[model samples]
Target: MSATENGWQPAPDLPPPSSSVGIIGWIRQNLFSSPLNIFLTVVGLYIIYKAGVPILDWVFWSADFSGEDQSACTSGGACWVFVGQRLSFFIYGFYPESEYWRINVLFVLLAVLIIPQMIPAFPHKKWLGWFFLVGFPIVSYVLLLGGSFSLPHVETEKWGGLMLTLVISFVGIVFALPLGTLLALGRRSDMPVIRAICVGFIELWRGVPLISVLFMASVMLPLFLSEGAHFNKLLRALIGIVMFQSAYMAEVVRGGLQAIPKGQYEAAAALGLGYWRSMGLVILPQALKLVIPGIVNTFIALFKDTTLVLIIGLLDILASVQAAITDPAWSAVAAEGYVFTAVAFWIFCFGMSRYSQGLERRLDTGHKKR
Candidate 1:
């Protein structure tokens, strides 16, 4: 026996504990204890070499980058130069080459509006509501779609490819958010009629698929209109997407509302805050913050769903790629077109998800600290 300050310690009469006795020892005893591990290691290395070597060779070592046309790419490897040649058309679609700068400016403005909102240090969060929620869209529409002032009118029919996809997704998120908030409030309203109406609206839309909604917009929408009534196809799709996505947005917001403790409501009531005041000042800010990640994910899903517009005959990015490949001159390069589209989609989606993760961290505020 050994004596210590706090208590008696075990006597050092037994052999010292071996380092390789727990997890490391167990691994050595089973995995590397015999000839099987060495054999498996060798087999794994061989498989890696067999698969990776040829792929690395074909993708980069033997790939063609300087070809004038697909015919010049005879190296039995990828021909990425085709993408470089027609990249602008793929991104901007039928948007006039001369007016491509307007799209560029519009994208920059969106980045400016969104990026500042993501940062916690921005001085005027409320101002962003007016600017991004209201001003930017009007400016972008006037600048890109043109017509209102002296700007040349660019018909919505002319919009296609990635530009149309961006437009559709942007409009969906822009409209869905405010609409969702109202729906959430309505669902939680004190009045039975308002609550029932909001619940029915949310559930009905949520029950139906987005494709069905798009179909209704594409087919049934025109029939319901008065004579001589004309609607833009893009606008119709935008409306459908907004309506479908808003239901989902409402549910996400409702989840956030449910997460708020009753103590918060009680405290707000004790402060003599009215319903709207209590909700806006206390409940929504916290609830919305808690659900930011979910909302961003919904937006991402809506962005991807924009591709489904191809089924209804709208030429978004995916349809544009399909159109490109169907051209006889580019038939052999279909794989390249699809790959280019996939890469572009991956870029946009990955960037959005990363931004959402950042927002989650920024707004956590000890509620969900890692």
Candidate 2:
């Protein structure tokens, strides 16, 4: 009778045992779960502290923020004053300071359009895309060049700094993607002539280093033209970049296309859709989604490669920084300039990486219930 009345059910599970339930438990399970892990954690923390403290002190506490020259940097820390002094040059290069507003306007417009396009919830994406792909280029060309619209003419040669870097990368990406897609398609085409041409073109460019391609474009290209014929150096560089990059891009895209299941093609054909329609509607969307990371990697590489334009005499941001550091007053702060440039590049590349990851997550149709 006593046993029948005492039904307590083992104290209702006892709150998961204290050792496995709280903050201390979490730390034990994660950081110091094993002797090796504990040792590694301690060593890593010690290294970070030793390396980080001096860096933090140099970058923040002891840095010269409001000084005019190297004399102000006597504290054995970064001379941010050099960065402040030549910040304009690092950003705008030789572009006339009076017309900096033009670049500002372009930047503002890009932010307005691009920020929205990046947002998944934003409406009117199709219209925004049309404007971005077509209208914006025309408007930018008019605003930047300006000989036809009563605005002062600013030659392409005058473009430099971050502005030129952005221009070349943006143009290369915009033009390369579609051209690469076409080449990828042509490479896989049933038509012998198209396949041969595509293969030859891709092989020729992919076989050469970008430096060689740029040299050929800049040096050999002019020789092939008539004696009086002239081409813009920036344009020549852009052409070489597009040609070189598109070959790589085509390979990336072709890999994506090949990863796609043949069943998809068969399904689209079963629906009576033609080759272009099937690709545009079903195949490409999926293929492109699968290769988002590859495409982003290519883009990051292209962005960094813009620095190579310096070899051909275009003053990109890196070149501008180099030029600024040569000034006797700031030459001692070359490290600071380089660090700033590296940080800028890191920010842009990191942003692209984060965006690609987000896009991949969003487009992940293959995920299943875990």
Candidate 3:
């Protein structure tokens, strides 16, 4: 056996595997593996070149950025000048010019609080979370709607644009989440009365269109209330949006709750945890994490639906855009106005989507088979 007669010999050390394995292999496997794939890749490249080039030209090369009026748009391309002219209106609506600093401060405070909360690695998150949830809203309200401070009182009717849209969506989501979770739990309760009430509330709101709900809040709600009990229009709209969205959220949360295994509940109970403790400490955390995508989707939908407030005479971003384009100077450039509005909405919605994806990845505990 020691004789070199045995033909078995180690293969010569292959040259170190090529570094092309990183990107080149990936391209080969994904884009150019088969003849059909190669053809498709070429076709895709052609399509991109054809479509993307013109879009780039229009947005960058041909678009008008300067000048005060439509006459500045000489390039037979998009008249972005109109957007620039009415930018303030698009952002702040008819918010009083003198009080613009208050809005700016509110935005700064929001960013200061919210950015840290979104980042998981930030320290003292619990305290930050409490402040963001409990304190920020009070400060924001006082700043925006001043009656006590020497700051002049700006009527709710004066609130419009992106600010109003954000106010509605943010307040709606903040209130709806807890309410929805409770409704979901109640709907699954052992007690008949609580379950029945929860079921009815969810179904009633879910059955009606949001437009109808807003209409009821705007017109019918005022009629039902005592004449002396004057409700702010913005408050009425917020209530309607919260109620409408909470029903949808309850259903989404319920789906997540139902997806949990019975063993989880049994295990919690066996650990001597009472109902509230078991659900709050064990069940809800997992349930909510499991449905992060659904929850974020509901939030995105609610944000977009803020535009419907315009129907009730509340000027959200879309309403502000509409108002801006109504000016004869910018009427012809409605497309530009709408595109700006769409981009703004897209930024917020896309940010939410990316955050949800990151959260889902982080919370994934390998409970399910990959």
lDDT of model 1 at position 8: 75
What TM value does model 1 have? Answer: 0.84
What does candidate 1's lDDT look like per residue over 240-326, in tens digits? 899899999999999899888889999999999999899999999999989989998998899988999999988898998888777
TM-score of every candidate relative to the true structure? 0.84, 0.90, 0.86
- The CA lDDT of each predicted structure is 0.85, 0.88, 0.89
* Local error of candidate 1 at residue 139 (angstroms): 1.3
What is residue 369's positional error in candidate 2, in angstroms?
Answer: 16
Off by over 4 Å in 1: 1-58, 114-130, 368-370
Across 1-370, the per-residue lDDT of candidate 3 in tens digits comes to 8545697777678764564377877888889989999999999999989998888787788999999997899897788988888888877888899999999998998888878858899999778867876788888789888886898888889998999998999899888989999999999999999999999999999999999999999988889888799898999999999999999999999988987899999999999999999999999988987887889999999999999999999989999888888887654787788889999999999998888888778877877445
| TM-score rank order | 2, 3, 1
* Number of backbone collisions per candidate: 0, 0, 0
Say which prediction, candidate 1 or candidate 2, comes out ahead on lDDT. Answer: 2
Where does model 2 exceed 4 Å of error? 1-4, 7-20, 263-282, 289-293, 367-370
Q: After superposition, how far is residue 102 of candidate 2 from its true place, in Å?
A: 0.6
Q: CA lDDT of 203 in candidate 2? A: 99
Model 3 scores worst on lDDT over the 10 consecutive residues at 15-24
| Residue clash pairs of candidate 3 | none
lDDT order of candidates, top first: 3, 2, 1
- Could you give candidate 2's per-residue lDDT for residues 126-156 as a string of tens digits? 7997788778878888888778867899999
